[model samples]
Target chain A: MNLSWMAWTQPTAIFFIVIFCLLITMSIWEKISPGGGPRVGILRFETTRGDRLFLSLLGSAFIHLAWLLFAGSNLWWAMGVSILYAGFVFSFV
Target chain B: MNNKPFDNKAWFFVLPVFILVAISAVIPLMTVVNYSVQDSFGNNQFFWAGTEWFTEVLNSDRFRDSLVRNLTFSAIILCIEIPLGIAVALAMPRKGIWVSVCLVLMALPLLIPWNVVGTIWLIFGRADIGLLGFTLAKMGIVFNYGQSWLQAWIIIILMDVWHWTSLVVLLCYSGLVAIPEAYYQAARIDGASRWKVFRYIQLPKMQRVLLIAILLRFMDSFMIYTEPFVLTGGGPGNTTTFLSIDLVKTAIGQFDLGPAAAMSLIYFLIVLLLSWVFYTVMTNYGMDAPEKREVES
Candidate 1:
């Protein structure tokens, strides 16, 4: 019934502003350097399965969110174990 | 490759995510901002508090302790999970039905929700009834997560490792699978030792994914709450009181709005900053990736 808003203050305001500034700077850096990959850019990679990367990220996020909804705290522990198992794949699979 | 006409229509499908994220992320965020500067009493009575709570929270020892604890926990998790995941990846089958089975099995733990994971461990760690605690006692070991801070710490860390290692494993597996068999074949033809091959070939191939794994784990671990909260409730003392847990206590338990909002903002910024470092490091490493060739059949 009663809910208090607790997230607006000078520190809070300053913190978010700084985060946005940093994010903008990151975008600029990403454009300028582009990380020395194929130099092909997004349009060129449209031919490849680049869209799948977006699909995977979104899909994984949803999967985790679903897990959170269903299992609550148990989901985190399960996912924690899963991450370890996934790490094994990283090392030797 | 099918040179199908580029479809701008897919962007329409993505609109829901944009909307959803805006609602979930932005709305609560704005609400938090609103609370940070205002004072409220019962029945929606409110007044301007300005930055009073912010100054108090910033100067509070409790916040500092929780922040330190969270940082330490995240760092420890990164150290353990990243290497463990990589090791597991290195040991798995390259191509087989078994690979699929293993992947799914590993991913099963990840599919469970955070709170449920905590509940499972809570049940599993009881000295009187829990399998783990009972077994350890039977084997002449004393373990009590409910009372001892160290035990609580160990259980939480172990729970996290068990739950999240699979994510690292999956990421690393994908990275490993993407590697051309030619690299291994060439190493074999050159009589390279397994260790040498791993160090020189496999490690380099996996650097990008490993970096992503580390960053993801760090961010998640830093923000971890639900599981640990359900498990120990920030512990017998403040031993396990992570920053997020502390913020919740101050905000909800103590009803200290301004300070909680300030802490949340700080927490968010710290995560964002670390994530930026991770991205930068990964991108720089991406430059070193060689033009790989597939092995001929």
Candidate 2:
């Protein structure tokens, strides 16, 4: 609620930290196996692990925003739904 | 996975680019995300808004209208430029001194600064002193972009086509010239018709470049701001106010930081979604064909 230089609120920082961690994890995964595992899923295209991560993250952001608008501010349910959605994306899409 | 040795030194080369991206894109984007979730009064004071601005922007008729307008513009131009570019590229000499001349001419418009491109069109479309406007007047076609929305749209579309069609042409030309002489010789030996040659050989070769052209044009046109802003100022009753122009009006013209920030996130999300869809669909379509063909053969 209080302003700071560059608007570095705690939650926002956490959001970015999570994204950074995901990137580092992905990099490590790639280092272990240089060829990313790309497969055709429900999306009907070849998507590497990195692509799946991107799709999941992008979809989750929209899901989060939509839930915030329609279901009110308690985002715990939205978070749960997003996790299931991400799992689905990783497994099949 | 191939057994390539680990090379931590690669990260040293990549780190500078990563830092640049973090400083230029990530930091600024985080600031926007922060502003989007907070309400701001003057003097840098802020209160938690908690998605209120997102709701407001989503519900606004102005946002809806501008989005529709933006999508329509992008669609119309893509329809025109892609085919037209292909034809022009096809017509150009595949090998000769004239190829260099053609390339230099095509690149001229792209080299001009964007605002200058806007300024050029703003003057060129003026009914009083401009060549296009004067010619239209002489032909008995009444032309006033300030009063008529259709006329304003015409000029904007025309300006865009003139400025950007070269990009498509250049890309398609590259795609065309890359076709080895053997393919053409084979087509000739087969006695294939012109249309057949293009359909089987030339068109398939051009597919990758066409994808690049379409993606670039879609993103650029969807986020267009400067040319229309300079030319029409989003006037003629806001008929030409696309998403970026409207976002600027919200953020800078009215100085509403929260709503503007929220609008930007929405805009970015839409663009990201569409770009990904286009990328997936195009890559999927092209990457599957050879497998099927090989199996059938």
Candidate 3:
């Protein structure tokens, strides 16, 4: 059993193949339907411009990191604060 | 389904949520993906293992068993919660201060952290001093989750239902509230029975919300780890070990990075596929509805 290549080797191959399949399917779907699917609303900055996308990404990252700093080590607290911040952002912006 | 044609400006409002989900979901996913293809010997050493781990995971009995258990658990939870939630939603009052109170109370469990939910149930289901266990014992039921796999499964399932059924109820309640009073008035004028009114009007309105509820519940239940882990520790052997538990044990506990990553990827795909199926089914059904067709026309 220790010498067998099937132990770890087989599964890793299958995993990536599945991921590849997923990526391909998503690409095909996007091509076929264009704007028919749901957009990355809260995660995607509403701009198609590179500058705006970059700003939104950086700003959102800092907001998350700042939340973790304030909320301590608890993941739930961090999540809660980040969600509240997001809600605040939506409300104001 | 609403077809209200919301403005694109709403995307800007939603940007922050997407960012947060990306950090918590996408980054960890990428890390797992990185690990899945590499062989590591502890100290940051990596070698291309190609597809070795993926194939191994696919053939492993442990992976198969965990997947089966996860699928079964999700199915059972969906079946129990959806109908039960509808019933609870129907029973809730349409108006009054009590409605607010009940809503707040119902949401309390959802607000509690996953780990805390686990801790609460761990203590709550203890055979010695826990209310549930003590009462069951006194009633000669001999309930001991620690010792019996069936008892553990029962308790875990019940705990999940208790903790999450409120979410289903809330969604269903919102769906129910969104129905216009005019529909019910018409039903009353037409001498429709309560059951008939619920069947013909309320249920159809609820389909969208129910689809969301079922998908959310299924995904969450499929990925469930903390509560059951805290309660039974996947103990009395591997009988209670779901996919997430096994994946965690393999990844973090055994440091079997390749297998763990592969398992996580498989787990992720299963969820994605199932969710897609649910979305497609719901959308197709919604589009096929006679009223929806008439309204569209």
Candidate 4:
């Protein structure tokens, strides 16, 4: 297989490289500190650390999507909305 | 989980999420409802349309076609992603260092913005500039996403699978990990095959998270706009024009606010109704019996 035609743009390369680094770091972190025991928060559901991270990420996506749909493409406003969303998820969800 | 003592003060902590969702969801929703029944033709001048737009939109072949396309896309995505995600989750390491490594890698695609995902695919599928496209051409296969309807559909669907299957994997993995060791040990001691163990033990345990996964994917795919918009622009002769793309074309592209608003309300209702049906059907089955028993005890 010829690999000569590969398009290794800076952003694409950076994206994958960062992801690779994240995986390595996360593995090392998990190896060092093993447990992610579930804890009940204000949401009335038991969630682990990973669950909270997922919730925050999902919530922020919705925030940005909603902002784009309704408020138009003023990203500063969307960022503001996302920050509030993150705060709420981190605190309760 | 519902057995916690009544604590009215807990509402304070919940207030922020409620407010945030309301501001994002409810207020814009009301605006859409308002616009749906009113006609505006520049200069902020408005006249009461009184379902005229709704009648028009309902009667339009374009709107109906796009809605059908949207449903088909969502269905296809769910069928592909849910099983694929579950399989990936099952294959994932249950313990040790590799678990985090796999999780972070799987989650990487999801973190990238929707537009960026589309752009990546757009560049990656171009015959002149992309490896995939170039390789296909070299193999003497005609592949051009920009000009061919089928190719555009294929790319869009593939992009969605790449972007979202990870969500399903993550949720299922979480559910899988949460299963107690005792249950697995019991299954092992009973000499159950792997399929039997999954069918009886893992599947039932995953039902709740699976329901959540299904609902989220359905809603997101139903509302999908950015990725397909950036990729195909609802094009190659409107073959990939889902409801949101068509709605935006009506509202912003042509500046037809009344009909667009009507279409938006209809679109929102379809999503809400289907999600409700999915939630009720999934939760009301074998899941509810245990909860009822707990309450009785």
Candidate 5:
């Protein structure tokens, strides 16, 4: 259980903090809205808003990963791809 | 899966995505195509190279070797992860407060950044300070990832499995939870064995999620760069240098934009072709299962 080797750098701390904030935000939003019943999408399945959100985030991670792998790590292209992916999720999913 | 009235106005909803993807994928891809065919040294001056870079890259042993390595790595990962993930998912609790706890713990590895995962493992596998490395060393085993090609591959593969198996588990869990209670009840009434119940009922139900999981894992593993890059930096030799690593080395490290662009196009095409083959084969296999189709309909 020793964690003395763990370095809590600014980026690592911010990453976790942002994730925590996102979870809080999502929970609050879910409570306020209170409806995420599944709706049929292009993928031959029913997905809720939460599912779409998850898919969009996952897709964005892949897009960035691919961009880094193929293109250089400039990330402008990846950002564009992520924005598009999010739009697709919201509109279609 | 649904029967909604066809409407032309749906196109408007999809227009934004089209524009965005086009701007991101198409435009940059075209830039690569341009680079692949032309030569540029500096000052924005360029001359038509006329597929010289393409021929050179296509003929190179380095390019071929890296492509083979990438394919081998992806295939091994798929073979290992899919069944292992399914087994873990099946072993998990179907209902309880512990479900959330298990899911969160499983998903925690996935959320960490790729470079960070590499760094974590990098330190975690050091014989001097890291826990796993120290333990392994204490057992009279020499496990230096930095110096051994096989150890580097082993560590990378293990890291990938740890980071990605959760995704497969989550997807499979969702699919499993979605199964109607009637199926299980019917299985029980029919005195079905555990293996038969799983084969006829659970496996069919999990088909869609499994497809997705496989596709995602394939693509990700094929294009893996950051984690291994951070871990071995492509090795003690050129052993762990997969296609993406080599491409980055060429494009950025050596500044050979022409050959890199050519290789990039070739690499993209290979992935696209293989994925198409995988999707077609799996979907056709699904189609062959008449009972499954009837259930869906």
Candidate 6:
């Protein structure tokens, strides 16, 4: 939490911490099961779990930005939408 | 299908690289994200404004115009550079001492710093003093890039083609040389035409490197700032004020941190999405070709 060196806000720091946690959780999941083979999805590419995580994160960023542009500053709706998108990416892509 | 034993111990080896990337990239990127959602007054006073800048920047005429310019520039450069690079690569000598000399010469332009390349063209295109414009002035035709938008565009595009076509040529040349002699000998024995030889053997071999060349060129052109900035300061008028130059004017000149930060994030996302699309399309295109050939046979 002592992030003055980089001048990070609490929320922004928490956002990155969540991403870091996701990575750790993913590694642990991979270790427990170990068969995250690349699967061709509707996106038409072979993507493993890691790649799907990446896709979800990237998609979420765009979704958040788009939401801000069109729907204004109430971003809780955007976060909900992003969570669903990540679910969709994980399940299918 | 990596079936090696799943060991938790392996993560430690990758930790140093992860930490380095975190320090270099993620930390700075977080700072930008922090600024994007906040309003900052002088002397480090900040208040959370929550995406007001993002909406403003996205809706602005200036941002939209600069984006269109950036896209057009990337498209024009990619269209010109890729084929030219491939053609120059094909024309290169494949044997003897000439190959090294040719490579060194090809690399000379790339060796020049980008700003220096811009400065060189700035002087080189001046009508009264420089060779290109002076020679044109000596004839009936007179031109000044500073005065005309079209002339500025022409000079910037010409300068880019001269500077970066070498990169494509180098990548394609490396791809060409990797093709075995046997393929050429077989093609020759088949009495294949020059075009057929190129279309079938040489091109398929160059596909990987060409993908790399195209991706690099597209990304570089989109993010281009130094050369055109130095030459015409993003060319001339509304047409040549690409996103980067516009971003700098907002961030540094106006010192509008919120809008600039928002623009930077938007710009970063656009590049990331396009690069992803390009990678997907090129890889799938290459993958489909061999499978289609197999099915036809």
lDDT of 4 at B243: 93
Scored by CA lDDT, what does every candidate get? Answer: 0.73, 0.88, 0.75, 0.79, 0.81, 0.87
DockQ of each: 0.14, 0.52, 0.03, 0.01, 0.02, 0.50
Shift in Å, residue B40, candidate 3: 2.3
Interface RMSD of each: 13.7, 2.2, 15.2, 17.6, 16.5, 2.8
Off by over 4 Å in 5: A1-93, B1-23, B275-297
- Mind giving the per-residue lDDT tens digits that candidate 3 earns over B126-157? 66888887788888888878889998889889
DockQ of 4: 0.01
Q: Candidate 6: where is the Cα deviation over 4 Å?
A: A1-10, A35-37, B1-16, B275-297
Q: Which stretches of candidate 4 lie over 4 Å from their true place?
A: A1-93, B1-28, B278-297
Candidate 1, overall lDDT? Answer: 0.73
Q: Per-residue lDDT for B20 in model 6?
A: 100
lDDT of 6 by residue, A33-62 (tens): 777757899887788898788889899988
Task: Tell me, per candidate, how large a share of the native contacts it keeps.
Answer: 0.31, 0.50, 0.00, 0.00, 0.00, 0.53
Pairs of residues clashing in candidate 5:
none
Please, what are the lDDT tens digits per residue for candidate 3 over residues A1-93?
Answer: 332222334454574576568558655764555543433344342322222232333344445334434543344565565456645553433
Predicted model with the maximum lDDT: 2
The per-residue C-alpha lDDT of model 6 at residue B177 equals 83
Sorted on TM-score, highest at the top, how do the candidates line up?
A: 2, 6, 1, 5, 3, 4
In model 1, the Cα lDDT at residue B261 comes to: 72
The alpha-carbon root-mean-square deviation between model 2 and the true structure, to one decimal in Å, is 3.9
Question: How would you class the docking of model 6?
Answer: medium
Candidate 6 lDDT over B1-297, as tens digits, reads 367765679889999999999889987889888888788875676777776888899899999999988899999999999999999999999999999999999999999999999999999998878899899888967688877898888899999999999999999998888777888899999999999999999998888778878888988999999998898876557667899999998899899988899999999999888877776776767556445544533
Interface RMSD of 2: 2.2
Could you give candidate 2's per-residue lDDT for residues B142-258 as a string of tens digits? Answer: 999988999999899998998999999999998788777888899999999999999999998888778888988988999899999999999898999999999999999998999
lDDT of 1 at B64: 79
